[model samples]
Target chain A: MLIHFHVNGKACAVDAAPDEKLLDTLREKLQITSVKRGCENGDCGACTVLLDGRPVASCIFLTVKARNHSIQTIEAFGEPGHLHPLQEKFRAHGAFQCGFCAPGVTLSAISLLNQNPTPTEEEVRRAISGNLCRCSGYVQIVEAIMDYVEERRAAREEL
Target chain B: MAAMIYPHDSCGVSGATSVFLKVDSDGSAVLYSGLSDVGQGSKTALSQLAAEILGIPMDKITFIAGDTHTTPYDEGTGASRTTFFCGHCVKEACEKARTQLFEAAGRMLGVPSPEKFYIQDGVIYLKTFPECHVSVAEAAHASERIYGHPILASATFSSFSTPADPETGHALMFERHTFGTQIAEVDVDIDTGEIDVLKLAAVHSCGTVINPNLVEGQIYGGVHMGLGQALMEEMLEREDGSVVSNTFSEYHILTAADMPGVMLSGMVERPVEDGPFGAGGMSEGAPSPTAPAVGNAVADALGIRFTSLPLTPERILTALKAKQSSQRS
Candidate 1:
């Protein structure tokens, strides 16, 4: 089967097996290394990606089902020289240590801020609850998200 | 609380060195080592040490590590010894390279004593006559031209070895000891037998914080692992010894929602005698005290002691029922 979708603001087309996971297509076919394969099941959010502006685990999601949907990976953010605000904040706050789970966590946070721009600390915790980071407990990660939100608000107020 | 000391066994023989320094004609240097990062930030810490000792900017140093074909033998990265043991090797290697650089700079500057010269920001200069100087690139080029090889130096380090006593099986086991104390506050529901950790506070000493951010990250991760052991993590096996609970859903780890509301941590920066830059190993020792602290807190909350791991709801209820039945009897 041939499937066409938009990835990271670019149109992409790939031939897919009916049972092939989106994670495989993105990593193997398209060469997007950010969509890591942590757990094949939906338990670990390491393979999370945005489908139609909402976060979903790509490892469990079939590529055939993603036709016409907009898929977003960490690459949608900034690259090496140009970093997204979330990535910048994450680095500044030391949110990630091993950085294996950073892509999924960052996307989940993007989805969170997209829905609720100003969330409480508890809300922030719940937003990224699905992603798992073995290194750097969720303390700094949550703080980074909260700090980004606060900084955005302050910037908006100045405007 | 029972007093216990668990000997750290993994990092005993761990070692790494800048086996070679290939100084390009441009003065840039590439350092080779076998220490693998594995996300513990050993690369950054070791690189910082090298940069400090070499008197070169961090950008000027390229660290090559974790490949057997390119790097030397390392005991591997575990036991929290990368920064302590491997760092010592890096320090020594950089010092050796520094000496070579000074020697070359002395001959070029016509100085009899190389000690009278110093290197800063990759530039070697006379301390007495600051006007006369040679860049590290120039020094390397001059040394290679005169000595017929690139400027290279290497060093290996091993901590003091204490032979174990055969009778009691105890020796001066570890090269250095890292100490930590953690306090956990939990809320236990009497009716539901649920335990919710409200806060966690950890005060630890790993000796002379190399990177404060990285150290704090290790502490946070350690507490999370300890929470898993204390509350909900378990590995189950059947009669034939086949494993169950193999997946993340079955074998649960702490999530953001499960995290405590407040995490308070502090460090005691007491430098160890033989450690590199007076630093000791930390990550492995961070989780040691957490389970006991949380268990004690739960006992304080419920007025009963539960001896098994995970402290599951069913276990808590079973312990409560046994207590009640005993009181009735």
Candidate 2:
């Protein structure tokens, strides 16, 4: 089946099999490989992406279900040369290690920040709980989000 | 020093892990590396190393990571190698670029080399003279104009071992050992045998923390995983080894309401010299310490060293009854 959705701020079209999982459509059809396949049963959020600005596990969603929505993957954030502040903040805080689950986790945090620019530590924890990271204990990832929230708040206060 | 492995050269000092450093015209720096930042703080730690060496504010530096196809071949960001191995490759990449920066500033300043120069606020300055200085972006552009290449550097690190293993597969027993200890405190209901982890203390040695807040995040997250391992989280099988607990309803993980108390501690002794700022290791410290800690803590609370995991209430009660029967003799 043919589907159309806004991806990374651009209009694109792709042919996806009706039974194809969203993860396969994104990785194989669209060729966006940042969202990794950790547990395809939707237990791990490694394949999380923004479906109309809400974070959902791509592995569980049917490719056809995404026909009319806007989806955002990690690539939408920024390229290697030009990075989103959160990506930079994530780096400054060392929120990544072996990075396999990075894209989904980053996108999840970004989705939360977009809705609530200022999130508490617990909020950050709850938001990212589904994304499993077996490295670095999730310390830096949460800290980076917390720091990003504070910085944005400070900037807003100054304004 | 184990070289960089699959993603971040995971072997020795030099590996195929790629750390890309790019400084903008405005003194803002962005680092793009293949390192996975799946919660280990590798992005932040590597950025700190680059920002520290480049003399830029941590906020000014950004990281682009973990897009497997686009990002460098990092070892998939596991086994605590990001900071140790990837950090070195990044450090070297930055150092290699720093040389060109200093060299360019030297010719303009009439110095033999900018060896002792420092990069600050995007400005390159002589450590000794302190008077002669140049903005890194401008100097880099100037260097490009003069030497025909921008101030850019790349490092690809791989774990320094052969993929082919001797029969034992022990040659890579531990590229580097990340040690840790966990202490668990549980409340075992004498009747129900249900164990509640009242509190937990986890001491880790993943090396120097690139970010304390981030490390704390790791602790709590790990504690939750530990909590799941202790009170719940198990796979069920039948007599023929057929799967039984095939769903979340059957095989459960601990939830937030469980309110498992946690204390994060560590023994970083020292960062491996080649590793990121002497930091080494990661979440592998979580599981090992957790089960034992919970088991010991439950014994402390109810006075029984239950031998198996997931000391369910039925098992605990049966064991308690058995212990009492044994004591009666």
Candidate 3:
């Protein structure tokens, strides 16, 4: 099946198998390695990708179901020398260790911020509950996201 | 809860790890080691050790993990020995390469003795005359081209331990040990047997900490793992060799929603001898005390002692019912 989708804001068409997951289509076909293959049963959330700006587990999502959808991966978040503020916050806060689950967690956090920019700590925790990070225990990760939110609030107040 | 871990093989035998350090012409260094960083940041910590000895920025050092063709033989990372044993190996290799680099810089600066030179930010300067300096890159280039000796070294750090006595089974199983203490506070509902860990505080004396951020991260992560072991994280199996709850959804790890609201962590640096920059193994010890601490908290909350792991609701409810029945009878 040839599926047409916009990935990272770029129109791409991939010849994917009917049974292939969106994770396979993005990683194997589109050459996007940020979406990791972890717990392919959609429990770990390591393969989270944004479908129409909402986070979804790409591993269980069928590639054919993604036709005409606007998908976003971590590659769309930032690039070298020009990191997203969340990435910068993650670095400053030491939010990750091995970082296998970082991309999906970051995407989940991004989706949360997009929906609720001023979420409470509990909301932040609930938002990223789908992603599993074996390292850092989600302490620094939550701190980073909250810090990012505070910075954004401060910046907006100043503006 | 308090605990101590020996930084060696538990069977009263020495453990070993190896590393190869190569300083390039650009003053950049690459550390090839068979030891890998499995989310504990051992490679970064090792690179920090090398960079500190070589007087180069950490960014200038590239760490390659477990390359069979390039890296030397290592026993791998375990028992929190990566920083303790492999770290010493990295320091030894860096020191050897630093000696060669200083000698090359001494020759380039017209100094008689390499000991008279000091390195700072990849620049080697004469201690007597500070203005007389040479870049490590320049000296390394000259050492490779003109002197025919590139600054590179390989080191193997090994620990020795005496086997247990044949009669009493008493022996020095480790030369160094890491100690930690953890406190866990939990809220348990007597009816539902649901446990909610309210807070976790941990303090560790793991000699000199190589990286404080990574150490704290390990403590937090350890608490999560410990919490799972205490309250959840069980492998269920059906009869006739069938496995259930094998996936993450069924086999639950600590998620953000399940995390305790307050996590307090601290480090105690004693700086033991023979360690790389007086650092000790802290990663493995981080999770040791957590399970016991949570268990003690649960025991304190409910006036009963549960022996087995994963104090699930069913077990807790059964224990409570049994206690009630015993009291009534």
Candidate 4:
């Protein structure tokens, strides 16, 4: 089957199996190694990606369902030497350890910040509830997000 | 079941690790080692050690880790030994390079003795005449040009020794020992048997802290893993030996919402004479006491004693019901 989707702001068309998951299409076909395959049941959230601005687990999301939709991965956020605010904060705060779950966790944070630019600590925790990080214990992850939110708000006030 | 605290210590054993250092003519250094950084920040921590000892900025050092063909042998990156064992090797290698650079710099400046010179921030200067100095790049270039070899040094560390007592095995089982304590505060519902951990406090003594941020990151990660083992994680096997609960959804780990409301951590820095920068192994120690601490907290909440793991709602409800029935009878 042929599926057409915009990945990382680039138009991509690939041939995939009928039962192939979007994770496979992204990783195997498009060679987006950042979309890891931690748990194929949409549980670990290691393969989270933005589908039309909503975070979805790519492991269970079928490639066929993503036709004509805009998909985003961690690669879309920032390039080498240029990092997104969330990525920058995550690095600064030491929010990641093993980094196996980084791309998914980063995308989930992006989704949360996109919807609610300003979120309380509890709200931030709830927003990333679906994503599981085993390495950093989520403390620094939450702190990084909160710091990013505060910095953005401060920038807005200056404007 | 009893609201008792269990205190324990574990030995850290690291054996025969090697690190290779090569100083380029440009004053930059490359470190090659078999240690792998599985998100534990060994690269950053090890590089920091090299930079600090070599008197160069961290960015001036490049680390090549876990390469079999290029790097030397390592026992692997577990048992919290990367920082303790590999750290010593990296430090020694860098120290050797520093000594070599000082020797070359002394000759370049026409100084009689290398002791008259000291290095700071990649510059080797004479104590008496500070203005007469040589950059690390210049020293390396002069040494390689004269000696006909790149400035290179390597060190291997083997701290583990064989146990003397054959039966009891009492002879220095580990190279170092680390101590820690973890306390968990939980809110339990008698009816639903649900437990919500409100907060957690962890106090650890892991010798010297190389990086405070990395240490805290390790503690948080360790606590989270311990929570999973205490309240939710389990591996089930059938009568035929078929395993279940193999997936993350079925084998649940703590999510962001499930984490404690507050997590506080503290460190005690008692430098070990042999440890790198007075730092001992701490990565594995963080998860050791969390489960028991949470268990004891649950026992405190309910006077009833439950000796099983996970403290799942089903088990908690069953225990409560048993207690009620026994009371009625």
Candidate 5:
């Protein structure tokens, strides 16, 4: 079967199996490696991707289910030498170790910020709760998200 | 609330490792180490050690790690030994490379002795005449092109230990040791047998801190792992002995939502005599005391001495009911 989806704002069409997961299609067919292959079940959010600007576990999500919807991966955030503010904050706050869960965690946090620009610490924790990070715990991850929120708030105040 | 202490960095596996450093004519340096950074940022920490010794910016240093073909042999990156054992190896290699660069700079400056030179921010200068100096790039170029010597060095480090006695089961183990303490505060419901950890605080002595952020990162991560063992991580099996809780859904680990609202961490730096920059292995110790601290908290809350792990709700409820029956009898 063939599926058409906009990935990172670029229109793409790829052949996928009828029962293929969006995770394998994106990784194998589209060659988007940022969408890591973790627990293929919906439990571990390592395969999370933004579908219509909301985070979803692509591992269990069928490729056919994402035929027309736009998908976003960590590549959409920013390229090398031009990182998103959130990415910069994550680096500064030491939010990750190993970085296997970074893409899903980052997208989840991004989706939360897209809806609520100023999320509380608890809210931030809840946002990336599905994305499990074995390293650094969730302390720095929460700190990074809150720090990004604060920076944006400060910037808006200056405006 | 309860307090507990524990130790980490098992055995002396990290003690046997080596690293290689190469300084190019462009003044950029490359570090090769067998240590792997699974996520704990040991590569960055090792690079920082090299940069500090070489007097170069972090960006100028390219770190290549865990490459079996190109890099030298290493004992691997576990037991929290990368920062201590591999750190010393990187330090030694960088120091040797620094000496070579100083010699080349000394020859270029007509200095009689290389000992009269020192490096600062990638620039080598004469101790007597500070003005007589050259950039690391210039010295490296002169040494490689003119003197026909490429600036490179390698070092191996090992922590001492003796095999256990077969008869007595006694032996000197682990050359270095790290210590830490953790405190956990929890609220337990007697009826529901649910435990909510309100806060967690930790203090550690890991000798000198190579990287504060990475250290904190390790502690936070270690505590999270320990919490899973304390509260809910379990594996089930059938009568035939096949695993049941094999997947993430069945075998649960702590997620972000499970973290305590207040997680505080502190470090106590007491330099090790023979450690690299007075730093020792710090990562393994953080997780050791977390389970004990939490278990103690639950014990204190119910005035019960629990000897087993997880302290699952069913176990708590069973213990409570047994206590009630005993009191009634």
Candidate 6:
């Protein structure tokens, strides 16, 4: 089956195998390198990406189901000189090491923030519960996202 | 960028994925580096070192660490090697530039040994002459012209390993190894036999603290893995060594609900007589204390020593039954 969708705001088309995981299409065919390989069974959210602006583990998603949805990979988040505030906050707050799980973490945090612009620390942890970080523990990652939420909330109040 | 000063507006937006630095004809310097963003804050830490050495603001540096073929060779950034090793090389490269600042100052001053010369705020000055303040790029260019050369120094650093004695496991390489302690607190449900990690505490000494936030994260990650090994995750096999419990339904990791409050504590970062930044590796701690910490915690909670990992409900009940029989005997 041929499927067309918006990936990172760009139109994308791919031939789909019904049972193929969305992760295979993005990493193997499209060559978006940010979504990493950890546990293929989706236990580790290392392969998380945004599906229609919500975070989902690409490893478990069926490629055929992505027909008209919006997908976002780490490559689309931002680049040098133009970074998403979450990435900046993560860096400033020291939210990563080895960085194997960074892309997934970044996506998961963004997903949480998208659903609830103002989230408590516990909420943030629950939102990112599916993902596993092999380094930096989860303390800093949680701190980084919490910092972003607080700062964003303050900025929103100013507006 | 290496010394990126992220505006609050771009809080979640990560861009400019690369960096580098350059020196102008004047006394200004710039840095370029790929922002691998190792989460140890290599870019910020490296820029701090450059600014410390080159007498420039950390923001004056730029970096590019993302596109591997374009920027430089990084082995995907693992094993806690970024700070002690990579930062050492970056510092040395800046020193090479510092050397030129001295050489230029030396030729004009007719002074000896600019190696000891100091620069502050992009102004080269001799401690011997407090009145003389000169721009760095000016001095560098002048020295290049007078000495008939251009000085652009680049460096790549490789991390080394230890020479440990096979018998005793004692050795020396990059300073010394780090030691960490993990304590687990758990409670097993009598009916369900589900073990719960009530609390986890870890104390680690991985040399100097480059970033406390990063260190805390490392501790949390380690304890979480320990939690998984204790109650949920297992690489199980059949009696014939065939695979079972192969999927997420069986092989489990800790969820937010399964975790307890983590307490991070420890110290061990003062530099020995040797070492890059007096820092050691952190990779080992994530897996080392995990099993033991949870094992001891399970014992504390259940009053039974676990002979094997992953104290699943069935296993706990079995052990409990055995304990009951022994008590009756």
Q: In order, what DockQ does each candidate have?
A: 0.83, 0.18, 0.83, 0.87, 0.89, 0.36
Angstrom error at residue A88, model 4: 0.4
TM-score of each: 0.95, 0.65, 0.95, 0.95, 0.96, 0.74
In candidate 4, what are the lDDT values of residues B192-297, reduced to their tens digit?
8899999999888867888989999988999899899889999888888887888876788899999999999888898966888887678788888888898889
| Top-TM-score structure, candidate number | 5
- Alpha-carbon DockQ of candidate 6: 0.36
Higher-ranked by lDDT: 1 or 6? 1
Computed on alpha carbons, the lDDT of every model, listed in order, comes to 0.84, 0.72, 0.86, 0.86, 0.87, 0.69
Candidate 3's C-alpha runs over 4 A off are: A15-19, B1-14
Q: B174-224 in candidate 1: lDDT tens per residue?
A: 666778888888898878888898989988887888888888988899889
Per-residue lDDT value at B250 in model 6: 72
Worst 10 residues of 1 chain B by lDDT: B1-10
lDDT-best of 2 and 3:
3
List the per-model TM-score of the A chain. 0.97, 0.96, 0.98, 0.97, 0.97, 0.94
Candidate 3 displacement at residue B307 in angstroms: 0.7
Most lDDT-accurate candidate: 5
Q: For candidate 6, lDDT tens digit of each residue in B225-291?
A: 7667766778989999987987665777665545675545454565522334554445445556767
For A6-88, candidate 4 gives per-residue lDDT tens digits of 99899988998889899999888888989998878888888999999899999999999999999999988986799997899
Q: If both were scored by lDDT, which would come out higher, candidate 2 or candidate 4?
A: 4
Question: In model 1, which residue pairs have backbone atoms overlapping below 3 Å?
Answer: none
Binned by DockQ into CAPRI classes (incorrect, acceptable, medium, high), candidate 4 is high
For model 5, how does the per-residue alpha-carbon lDDT over B103-123 read when each residue is reduced to its tens digit? 999899888587889888999
Model 3: lDDT of residue B177? 79
